[model samples]
Target: MPAQSWKLISHFWGLKAPHFESQFVIVASSFSSFLYLGACYGYFAKRERNKIGKIQS
Candidate 1:
């Protein structure tokens, strides 16, 4: 939403400019999904480790 960000995105994409609303939504959704996936992975990995530890014990 900042002037510098718009310039960077336009330069990177080789476009005049990106639609602010659409880009914001896309970025927000992508970030949220990444966080969700990380959380899920961490939860499963911890559970698996605990299970293995129990088996070893």
Candidate 2:
């Protein structure tokens, strides 16, 4: 927040700066899940690609 904005808010309610520990955990978890899902998708897609257009004898 800008200095002026914080000063104005301070007149009524005090606003403290955010700590990064919890935010980092949330972000890390989100990225990890996304990467895991993407890897799973790629693995399955590659495995199915070879058989997708082939005729089964």
Candidate of highest TM-score? 1
Q: Flag clash pairs in model 1.
A: none
- Model 1 lDDT tens row, 1-57: 444664465455544446785577557655666788889999999999999999999
**Candidate lDDT values, in order:** 0.69, 0.58
RMSD of each: 7.2, 11.3
User: What's the C-alpha lDDT at position 36 in model 1?
Assistant: 82
Give stretches of model 2 more than 4 Å off.
1-18
Lowest lDDT sum, 10 consecutive residues, model 1, at 9-18
Q: Once model 1 is optimally superposed onto the true structure by TM-score, how far is the C-alpha of residue 53 displaced, in angstroms?
A: 0.6
lDDT of 2 by residue, 1-57 (tens): 244543454432323434554455445555666788889999999878857757463
How do the predictions measure up, each by TM-score? 0.64, 0.57
Question: What TM-score, to 2 decimals, does candidate 1 have?
Answer: 0.64
User: lDDT score, residue 43, model 2?
Assistant: 94
Write out the backbone clash pairs for model 2: none
**Most accurate candidate by lDDT:** 1
